[model samples]
Target: MATETFLASFGLVGLRLIERHGIDPAHFARELGIPSTALPDARTRLPSALLDSAFEKAARCIPDPAFALGAAECWHPSHLGTLGYAWLSSGSLRTALKRMARYTKTLGQRMSSRCVETPEGLQFIYDHGRGDTLTGWVMADFGLSLIVSLCRTNDGTDLAPALVTLRRPTPATIRPYEDFFGGPVRFGETHDGLLLSWQVADRPLPTSNRELATTCDAILASELATLQNDDLESRCRAHLLHELTSGEPSDTRLAESLGLSTRTLQRKLAALGLSYRGLLEKTRYELALRYLDDPKKSVTEITFLLGFSEQSAFTRAFKRWNGKAPSDYRQSPGS
Candidate 1:
């Protein structure tokens, strides 16, 4: 299976910062095992481990302790791919922050983000499974600084967080931390996170553009889906989704689409303790729920979309999967 990776746009941001500090990014790239060519392509995926190593190398070689904080200055929405655009067009900081937590996988699977409500404000917590080490502090700072920068970019205000906490111990100099966060900085905290008062998070932004946000949301969803389906089973399901509208995709057609012989495809599925028929059923069920979510798609239309010969057949499959009829499930998706 492919290793967890992130888009190269982030590395590019770091490279730009490196060059700004009078260091050669190419030298750092070679040391970090990153291809010089990969730095310019936003969509190129690089291993997550390399990102951690990059921060570590920078901490060792860079004279400035807070150099990673400059990530905000070099950041552009395009670096984050679709998620960046989705965040830019969000109506409010709350919406934008939640979208970051939601589609974070598009950046790197190892990192996870969450927004929690509190008496003081909304707390945005991020864990990339590396905040305990000395070098990890740089990564944490990079993340928090980028958040503040993106907020300023969209809201056109020097919005400050209510509070900021880093798991790393206090550095020799602290002014940079306070200036970047625009709030009180506390060190040696349980989590590397920041808090935004509800007033700031929920207030509508002047940059609010629902049409663009919605378009970006769809693209982000698609990007995430493609990123997640790296295995053979998922590859088959993706091909099946495109072919389903024509009819039930035969194993022969699917195998051909995947550049495999029918017998070879069957053998491979069996090795993984799966079957071709089972894959088709699961793919149809997955697509069925998505189609049902569209109120405009009638049951009959969705039936054909799943390549079912009859509405009754689709209904039976839907019920078998969810223990509820398609219409009922659509009405109460949580059920």
Candidate 2:
């Protein structure tokens, strides 16, 4: 379930990168013979074939081979507007990273951070999950970007690590890797991890906000609730949510997609106290709120982004569910 959720979140950021590169993703999707509009919702499990094709296409479109890694760095929450601001306002770097690891699903995946005290010092291990072979280079670059971001976030460009470990073996680019990490870089290690001086870990935080931290924790809990159930209902919800933004989400299609009979799928949903339509609507609603909160996106864009027919249709449905128009709800002071 964590894998599915993580994949979906990573896909969202991947889509953002595709758009940021000035590539017509819709056209690219169509060229690949997949529905371009349905991409946002199809995050649950991308067919390996399609994912490879898209990745290849993106590589060709971007002039910089390191585009994916660069995008990951620039889009980090600590650099983004509201999320970054909230992180910088946290009690300490530890607290900031905790908040980030907790709510990072709201942004992307393939990356996570955890802290542990070691006999020598403190370790902050950054883990990135699987991707294509080319992703190895991207991951290496991303790891470097992370170090840079961490130092910049703390306003200390002089930050250096005692030891840096990478999962991949040594390559021709080893020199750049050494330069970035500013220490010996070990390859073919048991894990891709980093070690920080204990002093840095214990340093007092530059920003502290108890109220904001509380709010962030609460939001993470709420998001986790949706993934709590290990029953048929939860599976159905997960499946549908991962596929909805792509098209007219259907129980039959979902069943077929999962290699199950339609009748069996219906039986499963029934056992979970839900139906196909109910789960689909629930998924759409959750994602709608997330997209609507972004001031950078317009209502029309949200409509297409969520796979709705039109702005009016999305508005009408949003009103039916929330008892207020989307724009008004988004603009409300407390919202």
RMSD list, candidates in order: 7.5, 14.5
For model 2, name the residue pairs that clash. 38-246, 41-242, 41-245
Please list the residue runs of candidate 1 whose C-alpha ends up more than 4 Å from where it truly belongs after superposition: 37-39, 230-335
**Candidate 2 local lDDT, residue 35:** 61
* Model 1 collision count: 0
* Model 2 Cα shift for residue 288 (angstroms): 32
Model 1 vs truth, CA RMSD? 7.5
Across 1-335, the per-residue lDDT of candidate 2 in tens digits comes to 33333333233345566777787766776787756444344224344345445666776777765466444344544233234555655554544555555544443334556667678776766655543255554554555455446545654456667787776666656766665667777877766667766665545555545455445544554554454444465566556656656755777888887678999888877886877888777767756765665567788888876778778988998998767899997665323
Candidate 1, residues 31-86, lDDT tens digits: the string is 77776735456567889888888778778878888888999998888778878887
TM-score of 2: 0.50
How high is each candidate's TM-score? 0.69, 0.50
C-alpha displacement of 268 in model 2, angstroms? 20
